[model samples]
Target: MKEYPIMFTAEMVRAILDGRKTQTRRCGDRWAKVRPGDRMWVKETWCWCWKCARLNDPEWYHSHDEDDPSIQLDKCGVKYAADSNNAFETCDPMNPKTRKEEFKWQPSIFMPRWASRITLEVVGNRSERVHDISREDCIAEGCPSQDWYRVNGGPEKWFMVLWCNINGKKPGRSWADNPLVHAIEFKRVKP
Candidate 1:
């Protein structure tokens, strides 16, 4: 039952959502009891939002049996239609046929403003090295031939995925060889 002293600020909360701020402390008379204005160390691994924390809570999770229907609602205030009658049709954004003709030429890709650029480092052999570059730099460097994908709605995480065309060969002899495309799990840097 460790305790943490966390001072909640709007900007810090925003930074946490943006993946810029990694750690937070929770202050109270319980747990790691401390006086006011005192700081508590928090590990990035322990930092999670209410939703994620709840989902991962063992006691609450294993005991819960009911489904929350509100989870299906879209941001636009539309509910999924249960009937197949087509009587309550809502505009589907994915339907290309219904899209405006004028906007047909525009790509359907949705890029976010936060991670338009991401710097990736290559830490291996030069011959096998794919490339060390940022997301924005890669996009600009490759021009029209560049490929990208979007990771839609999920926990407040830094959504970024950059790909390089590695000819059918794998970069490293071992599974952990390629440092360029390594998957780094998001852990709130402790403070």
Candidate 2:
């Protein structure tokens, strides 16, 4: 199967890591290339350790020149060093003592497939209006369970917040306007 790189915001990454998100929508030119049966490497901007950076190796990194052929990548594509006892460190911007070997706040688009901890298999895809999102689909999009019970916008409200936050507040870009969106349903692929 063909593999593609997909970018997501930090918040969306958290949702997916929680095992609550299974669907996503892509717009503009990015959606045209994706299809069912294709594998997607989820990319998110974040911090990582030197080892992690070496394993991911997304082009911007070059600090670690050494390579270990024995290390293996998990299904999520993360490679753990042999001596770390399966434990590794991640870059924490909040931490002031961070070392040079750490990678911090890198953009998701630059994330390499090897460093990705998430993979998705597209099971279905369709084009629909942003306003056409249903409550069920909202859940699939990774809305919090509590929002589902809200009497007002409920799940749709959550999605609206995310959409605007990600796509920006540009005119004519909103769910209320029912703009065209490419909806993709996917299942988590074990690493």
Candidate 3:
């Protein structure tokens, strides 16, 4: 089967890890070609330890030495953003006293397959209008608790808010616009 890389926000990664997420919806036909048994490597925000990179691959490290030296490298390899909040931070090298917190975590889009810790196998796929999302699908898409839904005016409302937040900026992709989307269902698999 074919393998693909999928990006997830830290919150979605947490939901997947907690077994609360099993499906994802993408605007347009982005995931329409995905089929059952195809594998997807989840790419979340991550950061590599500079010290470890330099020690392991001196040549590669030397070639890209833009990493700040002040950033602490407690781990030996890549650290996923979903694993913890304590990520490396950069301090002012010139002024050691200046402690502006700049996270070292790279964007999920830039993550490489080798650094991924979660894999998913597509179990089902379908296409439907964004507004056609059901309450069950919302839960599968990692909707929060009942209490959260109550606060946010139920599951569909919550999903709409989230959808708008992520896709509203794109033309004809807003929740109100109700664009067609690909609904991809998946189950966690071995990395």
Candidate 4:
């Protein structure tokens, strides 16, 4: 007789059957949605919503189609909470030695409600700064936000500016700094 390892606890097994685990599935016009009683192949690295597990084909999981907009958004929303080892810490932009090291990190501040229409501007000595400025919009929502990560790269030699609409009528003041690599500038369009 061969012996197999039991990895899932009774509670976890129960949760899976009860549709409590993170997964995604196709529903009507949408590609990913939550559904109950969906069967999922549980693995140490298989992390997803309950719906995704049922709707996602095993072979398609590793393919680029997994990057579908709806799938990405749903996954983004669940990433921090679902990952068992997610953590973050504050860092000093001025001092590198004082920075906290962790596997997962994000900004402590919540994005303003007007964040949907925000724009980013970058002014640097190199072309890379332009790409960096565009990547700033990848900030993940909720805990473990990507704001800090967006601004943490490169040497401590450049300045950055971030502007947004504060009152929905006029452009808010720009936040200028040289914490990372090249100076960046962001300007909000007047509404």
Please tell me which predicted candidate would have the highest lDDT against the true structure: 3
Model 2 bad stretches (over 4 Å): 51-103, 147-153, 170-172
Over the stretch 147-176, how does candidate 2's per-residue lDDT look in tens digits?
454865678788888888877566666655
The candidate, 1 or 2, that scores higher on TM-score is 2
Overall lDDT per candidate, in order of appearance: 0.27, 0.68, 0.77, 0.26
- For residues 1-191, write the lDDT of model 3, one tens digit per residue: 99989989888999999898999998756588889999999989887654434434556545553444432343345678788643434323243232222236689999766667899999999999988989999988998788889887998887888888889889998887889898999999854
Candidate 2, pairs of clashing residues: 75-191
Question: 166, model 4: CA deviation in Å?
Answer: 29
Better of 1 and 2 by lDDT: 2
Candidate 3 differs from the real structure by a C-alpha RMSD in angstroms, to one decimal, of: 5.4
Q: Rank the candidates by lDDT, best first.
A: 3, 2, 1, 4
lDDT per residue (tens digit) for residues 1-191 in model 1: 22232322333333443554332222122422333333333211111122322433468656654234332232122111111121223445354543332111111122121111211221111122223333443332222221222343222111212121222233442223433332111233332
Model 3 alpha-carbon drift over 4 Å, by segment: 55-75, 85-103
Give the TM-score of each candidate. Answer: 0.19, 0.71, 0.80, 0.20
Model 4 scores worst on lDDT over the 10 consecutive residues at 23-32
Give the clashing residue pairs of candidate 1, or none: 3-32, 4-26, 5-25, 5-26, 6-25, 6-26, 6-27, 44-188
